[model samples]
Target: MTRSAASVPTFPGSTILGQFARSLISLAKAFKDRREVRNLAEFDERMLKDIGLTRSDVTSALAEPIHHHPSWVLVRCVGRPAEAHKMTAAHKPRPVVPLASRV
Candidate 1:
C-alpha cells in the first residue's frame, strides 16, 4: 500500500507555522526592549551617565522607528566614548625600559 503525498507528516520546525512563531517571538522581544528603553527615560541624568548614556542619547534612541530596537542606538551611543578612548590609547607611545638596567 503506497501512501499519498498529502498524507505525509510535515515537521513543524520546517513549516510556515514555525516561521510565523519565530517572527512573533522576535516581535515580542523587540517590544520588550522598547519598553525597557522607555523606562530608562525616567532615570536621572547622573544615573544615565553612570551607565555611559545621557538624556539626549535616551531621547534619540526613543525617537527611532518602533520596529527598530532602541537599545541598539543606546549601545552605539555608549560604545562611542569607549571606542574613542581605545583609539586614543592605541596611538600613545609606550615607554621603553633600558635593557642594561636588568642586572
Candidate 2:
C-alpha cells in the first residue's frame, strides 16, 4: 500500500495554520503602521521639519494603503536610520512527500 503526495495531510503549523498565523501578524503590523502615520500627521511644522518631512509628506504617506508602510517613506525622506520596523516574508513549507515517495 502506497500513498501519493496528494494523499498526505498537512499537520498544524506546517502549511495552512502557518499561513493563517502569518496573515494575522501582517494585519496587526499594518494597523500599527497606520496609527503611526496618523500620529505623525498631527505633529507641528517644526516637529515635521526636524524629522526631514513636511505636512505634505505626511499627507502623501497617509494616502497610501496601511500595508504599504509609511515608515519606509519617512526613512527615505530623512536619509537616516530611525527606529527600525522589520518586515519579512511568510514561511513557505516544502511539499509533503509520502512514505512511498521517499528515495
- Candidate 2 error regions (>4 Å): 1-13, 80-103
Among all candidates shown, the one with the greatest lDDT: 1
- Expressed as tens digits, the lDDT of each residue in 4-100 for candidate 2 is 9989787766887889898889878877887998999899999998877888878887787766777777667665323232222234456798777
Separate clash counts for every candidate? 0, 0
Question: How big is the positional error of residue 17 in model 1, measured in Å on the Cα after superposition?
Answer: 1.8
Q: Rate the local accuracy (lDDT) of all candidates.
A: 0.90, 0.75
| Runs off by more than 4 Å, candidate 1 | 1-8, 11-14, 86-103
Worst 10 residues of 2 by lDDT: 81-90
Reference-based TM-score, model 2:
0.59
* TM-score of each model, paired residue for residue: 0.66, 0.59
Model 1: per-residue Cα lDDT over 1-103, one tens digit each: 9989999888866778888888888878888889999999999999998999999999999899877889999999998989999999999999998787656
Candidate with the greatest TM-score versus the true structure: 1
Candidate 2 root-mean-square deviation in Å: 24.6
